[model samples]
Target: MPTLVVAVFLAFFAAEYAVETGLLLLNLRRARRSGDAVPAPLQGVVTPGSAARSRDYTLANGRLALVSGAWSAALTLAVLLSGLLPWLHQALAARGLAGAHRFVAFLVLVSAPFWVAGLPFALYRTFVLEARFGFNRTTPALWLKDRAKGLLLSAALGLPLLYAVYGFMALTGRAWWLWLAGFLTGVQILMVWLFPTLIAPLFNRFQPLPEGPLKERLEALARAARFRSRGLFVMDASRRSGHGNAYFTGFFRPRIVLFDTLVAQMTVPEAAAVLAHEIGHYQKRHVHRRLALGVAGQVVTLWALSLLVPWPPLYRAFGFAAPSYEAALALFSLGGGAFTFFLAPVASWLSRRHEYQADRYAVALVPEPGALASALVKLNRENLANLDPHPWYSAWHYSHPTLVERLRAIGEAGRPA
Candidate 1:
């Protein structure tokens, strides 16, 4: 490898890890010092004691992320430096697995170690940190079962898709990325269409929103928005964690799913407000906008990868042998993080903007914004969110606005009843 190539890669590599570590620690300190008192905006809305617990929860998660991030980064750095990819490529080549089959085998072989390696961290997060905070609901046996299902799910869907991509790459010559991009775009659409009915039920049970005031209110809210759906359902999400959430799923029609824990704690109006906010995402086209942006990104990245895969120097810079699709995917997967690390703020900004837009739509739909504001506070307290994070760190990490910001935005919204 040329000294310059190695130097550039290492520089970006080290910088990415350093930036992540800094953000984690900075947010941790900010949360710790934010104190136990609720910010004035939430003074009447949120209890003071909840703020302290939220800080503790943030701290716990920050600590976990710091450790896990460092461990994973170190593991990745070691693997790249240790020349593992080339060895794997040679072993598979010796077996004479050609075209799509080779990529499929490579995907499975490389993914297994990563999967097993992450098991300990997953276990620790669920059994230790989350349990300490009273959020964990998953058992050890259930965890293993989930992992097994995940592996099966990945193999069932991922292999065939990858097979087609590699096959098209070899057959169609230079335009393989365009073909792969279209193929991937189709897969993304398929998943969205099927996830609500076919895939989601594989892990959690989903039942029709039980007949009650909450259901009646949610149905009314849906009707007001003129959104059609498979009807509302309650997911047994609390079976795994105490954290509560609600979302819209499905490609053609909307499927509103509420976590059981969310329903249990929130008042009827507050629950209705939450669902309104979710429905707003659909009504406002935020979901489709995101999907379009993501598909575009895939197309661009695949096009770039098609250009890079034939370059031997790029592989040698990372201590790999001559270029192959499997090697290109592995290298790109490992190295893409470093190159895109700086784009974190931009992505977060877009997401937060979408969130605020959705929030405005909710305010317009609901009778009042107070219920959504109150619901946000309850969610912040229950989920142990960092009420105040350093602006820089939040810009890089937070998808939604801080509670204070959202409350202010909600107050400012003058949308008609």
Candidate 2:
């Protein structure tokens, strides 16, 4: 029965990959034929030069994704079908480590190889592709510094978090998954509070928005939404890429962060519109809804892991001599994507729905609907977004609606695109 289940899992995994890769290839072909001419919808939004550049950019990234995704997927599958998990578990166990210490150490060791394998690809993407397109602002030293910070932070936070989780599991037995889900759900919410003040500063400098019209407009919007924003801030996002964006960070007191590049490029009103859109997300309770969905997903996942982890043949399928939490963790972390890819479309749909609601709320706050649409257009151009993604591809992968879809929604709200 376990072997049958494993076989079924592999089949589902294969089918999921096939569907995802098929859409990717379709999109790639669509992009190749996309041409240098700007579409009518984006005619005023992006210039011909920018459109041509976006085509090239999308193609380059698509090819990179294809090759890199294949490579990583192959690596993961090889490890699962081989006895690598069991071998690694034994090697770590031989170190006389036990419980959470053993598990965290095992994860670190196993993930290190893949992380190292990926460094060259990461370097190429940042230094070569992004640089070719004039997007790379990261110096080699900065890149290295970022990586080191991430590694240190991972150890700093992840070690203690995993230890507590394992401790709960030991205490709860069959109900460990429930305990874990509850603990992690709290942590997820807590991180939103901690991120703006604690974790983000480690990577990029976040300075308060200088007092001016822009600051005044944002605060006004926050007040209109009845949200006492923590504050409005500017992020030094130009250190890495040319992309411009704005977002709300933290939970209790959500501060608005506009990329310095975004501020530099767009007008103050457009910037206000963009911030309105972000604040709209908070006002419409989108963040809370997303957190709820994430928590629900985590609960389901932990429950699934509980049922699957103890099965002997599932581990044997991965060459584990016996069941080990460390081995199970590694398998799930590495291989679970293949099992869950089917949910992409559903998740994308939910996100797109939320975005429409947020867009409506943004217009309600900003009044000039075109300002939001115009801001969206400027962002699309700046980010080199694909103007006309295939419907299935968009459904599968797009968290937000495309420029066309968004403009249509805005038009419904009397925003002329």
Candidate 3:
């Protein structure tokens, strides 16, 4: 039976677009509802009765929405058109004009331009708009250097994987999902292993924590949470942005990285509160849960792609010349992207749940709910994060609970255990 692949692709896109736009509108309304109830510290950052300042924030959000929407649309179109290159390769093979591997190489070459198109917008958003907001400390030179490094690194690691995927689809099309899943899982494991030592240093500088009250408090919090980290390292995040963040990255080679921006302004107790949240993620097993969800999602997607690729109308629906291994890849990408668009809300909901769970774990372990609340307020103020995002927006895009929500949760947890 000929599958209406193009129709599936369009349906997927429409579903995603509707859900995303709806979520954004919901968040915008929530932001409006929060009104003057924004955390006290955040009020000082917004100049009261300053029309220009208000306009700037609104404009930035609008720009973010526009860029995000356009990006999704453009990439969808690229994936649909990509089927053309694969079809050409198939025709060449029929004429004995190219070997199978050459066709694979040609398909890979054709996809590079589409892959690179997103880079400029990403750079501009981080270096230009973020800089204008007094959030970026990264020099243009440093930004470009980092970008180049990322591209080279991705190509070095990803190219061979792509070739392997192509070979798997061509040779083991029936059980290709299992093979592809194993390969993908292996790559993920390798990346996790390399991230701390090889990947992270290419962007940020990490140093052992300085001797200070903050360090002592953090150690105490870590002990309370029953966690052990290799070292407390401070990252030079302030050089690139004013955003304050702390994360626990690396699995086997675990490290705790505090952004310099975080440490510079936060009090010792506040810093400890932040560290508690990171440790809470580990203590609650949120990382493992997230990984499980990711792997499951990948397996489902691979299985779906395997089914869709063998159907002939999928190629015709996308205006691809005929069914071929490479054509199947392009179709899968297009259709899969569309499908994931609607799936965003489901994933976002799960993520927000995990974040709330981690917050609960933090409050339970540290019993410093007040400090955690204060830290949340400070982080929102420093980062210029929207204190009053529409509830719908927060539900759809926010992985973490809103600052107010988090503080409220902390307050609720203040009861004697």
Candidate 4:
């Protein structure tokens, strides 16, 4: 039964990837066919040469399908091929090596092919595609530095947790869920607590916003929204990419964080308008609601995992013995990965709704609809974002409303009701 379930789960993910790739290919072909760059709310002000506009449009939508498809194929191959080893171990009764550690080592080995297969494509898009569109500001040295730091950070944060979870499952057996839930909750809290103060600084320098009119404007918006902020922080985002973004981080006391890349471009009014949108998230209590939802989901997941953890069929189907903790752990990891395949679209839908709500809140508070619209356009254009995308593809995949949809909302806000 467990083996059948695993097979079904894997098949579903494989199908989803195939569909996703088809959609991306269709979209890329369409974008290339359309010569004019779609009008962005940001580019409403600046005129670009026709050739430059065409280049940007093509790069924006091209290569997405190729990258996504290759990644999907690599991951699928890894999961399927790695299962063969445990099958061998189970047949031989060299069972000591078949447990969780060995299973994880097998997974790690499987991942190398996918990692190697995707790296060059990623590099080409970031360097050539983005540079051709005038968005790549990162030098090759800086790019490699960032990748090295990312690897270190992932190891530092992820390795110990993986070991702890595997160890807990192996040792506790039936009661691992309780310990797993507790550990995950603690880790989530710790990441939130330390993210603003510790982890962030390792990647980018953050300084308090200089005392100025912009600071006063931001503080005013925060007060109006009735949320106390730690202070405004500026992160050096330009070192990596020209993409602009802002978000509020921390739970006990959140700080308003803006990338220097964003600040460098927007006027004080525009920046304040963007800040107002972020403040809107807090004003509407979106953060607390999201955290609560996440906690609830974690509990539900733990319960589901508990049901399968004790079942012998699950281990046997995955080609491992019921008594073997390592085999159980590996199967559980693969199951978790499979479940995310279906859940991703649902999560993205909820997130997009939250963004729309926040945008409405921003319009109400700032009353600078034009500025917000312009800011979004410029950010998207500079980042080489696709203005027109396939609706179903965007619905399932995108976290935010497309630029055109956002602009329309802003335009609606400005109309006399």
Candidate 5:
């Protein structure tokens, strides 16, 4: 049984790694073939220089991804196959650490190596890669501070939550997974609700949209769409990067936030169009539907974990002498992606469909027919987004449709039904 499990693990791992490497290489090749030429749909909208930059950006990031993905896969496989995890568990047990405390400590310790290994890549991506393209604005001090806060926040929130999960597992009998699933779903929803007000402020300052025409326009659009929000606000995203975005957080009374860079770059109509697209998400209930789907996924994952946690051979396959919930959870978390990687395209497709729906809904609400398309084109150029991507690569990776697809869809959206 152990041998079979190991074989299955290695097979899935190899397949996932091959697929990832192939898609990245294929995308890079496709980008090289396309050169700097702006896609037909975007020729007039985006300048040749911007298109060239976008191509370079894509190639650079793709190369980085290829390297980083291989490194990550290799490190993960090494850690899993090594007797290190079993040794660590035994060491922790030897130290008189037991139960949830020991489990949390073990997880924290095991995760440290990956975090340390990733720092250089994260730094390069943020400071070197992003800065080369005129996107990075974060100082090293700010970066360090942010990481510190993130770590502290993780410990504060994650430790307690993990302890609670352990408690549920210990006390809830055979249906523990069901209870844990519901609890986790509720926690997820609560985090979403609190993030806009509580968690977000820790990282970046957000201010009210400042009683301007843009604010009035966005509020009016929301009212027109019959979507209620806490308020419109702008985030100081420029403090970190030049990339612009807009999103709403929270379940009820969500706050619509626009990146300061977005506000600075886009015209009033363009901003309105962008906000209208976000509002469209709410109007179409995409947010609620996605949330429900996420909860369902969590339920399924927990149920699977319940089934696997007790199997002794599963532990033996990974070099653990005895079945331990912590080991099982760690192994599952580490290895589950290889098993479920094929599902990414399905998720991406659903997300893209939602995006299309939101875009169409925005078109109906925005005063100018081409406002949303114009905004999208500007965003793509400003963000140095790849205007063209290989079909298979984009299908598997992109949560939102490509800029060209979006522009074409926006045009269709303006037409009479």
Candidate 6:
């Protein structure tokens, strides 16, 4: 049984790697085939130079992804099959640590290798690849500071949550999974509520949008759509990268945050159109719908874990000497992606659908129907986004429709009935 489990794990792992590599290669080939010419829909929207730059950027990032993915898979497979986990568990046991302490320590130690291994790739991407495209603004000192803060924050927040999970598993008997799932769901909600106010400030400064025409325009647009929010704010996103985005955070008292880069690049109408699109997400109840689906996913995951946590063969297949919740959790965290990779297209499809609905809603609310389309084009050009991607690749990977598709939809939405 243990051998069979290992075989199945290896098969899934290999299949997922092959599929991901294939999709990336296909996308890169499609980009290459597009040459330097701008697509017909975007002929005048963006220059040929911008189109060529976007293609090069796509190929650069895709190559990096291919290398990074292979490295990660190799590292994970080595750790899983090398008997390292069992040895580490035994070493910790010999030190007289048990229960939550042992589990937390084990998890931290196991994760350290992956973290260290990934640092070079992160650095190269930020300093080399992104910088080459004129997007990276993160200095080395800032990068190091951010990494340190992230690690500390993870320890501060993750440790308590992990300990609580262990406590429930130890104390709640067979119903532990149910209790843990409910507790985690509550935590998720609390994090959502607190993130905008408490967590986000740790990394970037956010300030209310100045009392100006843009603010008034956005406020009016929100009012017209009957969408209520805490307020409009701008984030200092250019501190790290030249990329621009806008999002709303928090379940209650949600605040609309626009990247300063975005604000600087867009006109009043375009910015208002962007805000309207964000408001459309709320008006259409996309946020609540996604949250509900996420909670359901959590419940299902916890239920599945309950069934697997006590299965001796699972632990044995992963080099553990005995069945243990901590071991099972670790193994699942490492290997679950092999099975979940198949679900990416489903998630991507739902997200794209939401984006289209939001776009339509924005067109209905904004004074200038073309503002959103123009904003989208400018965003793609400025961000150097892949203007054309393989259909299969986009369907499987993109959370939003490609630029051409979006422009076509917006144009159709604007036409007479």
Note the Cα lDDT for every prediction shown: 0.85, 0.84, 0.72, 0.72, 0.91, 0.91
Task: Identify the runs in model 6 with alpha carbons over 4 angstroms from their true place.
Answer: none
Task: Name every residue pair that clashes in candidate 6.
Answer: none
Instruction: List model 1 lDDT by residue over 137-171, tens digit each.
Output: 99989888988898899889888877887787788
lDDT of 4 by residue, 1-417 (tens): 766766776686677667767767776666666446545653544345542464455545456556666776666556654666466545445546555556455555544565666777779878977676666788888888877887788778876776777777767767788788888988998998898898888778999999998888888877887878888999988887777888899774688899988988888878988998888788778888888888888878877877876678766665564545455555565446655666767888988888888887777878555778777767765665666666776777888988778778778876779
Q: Estimated TM-score per prediction? A: 0.96, 0.96, 0.87, 0.85, 0.99, 0.98
lDDT of 3 by residue, 125-210 (tens): 88777777777788889888987898888788767877788777777758989888888987887888788778899888999999
The list of candidate 1 runs beyond 4 A from truth reads: 414-417
Tell me the deviation in Å of residue 270 in model 2. Answer: 0.6
Q: Model 6 over residues 151-217: C-alpha lDDT tens digits?
A: 9999999999889999998899998888998999899889888888888999999999999899888
- Number of clashing pairs per prediction, in order: 0, 0, 14, 3, 0, 0
Question: Residue 99 of candidate 6: its Cα lDDT?
Answer: 91
lDDT for each residue of candidate 5 in 193-285, tens digit (9 for 90 to 100): 789878999999999898878888888888888888888889999999999999989767788899999999999999999998898888788
Error of 5 at 366 (Å): 0.8
Error of 3 at 318 (Å): 2.1
The RMSD (Cα, Å) of candidate 1 is 1.7
Q: Which RMSD values do the candidates have, in order?
A: 1.7, 1.9, 3.5, 3.6, 0.9, 1.0
Indicate the residue-level lDDT of 254 in model 4: 89
TM-score for candidate 3, residues paired by index: 0.87
What's the lDDT of the predicted structure labeled candidate 5?
0.91
Lowest-lDDT window of 10 residues in candidate 6?
317-326
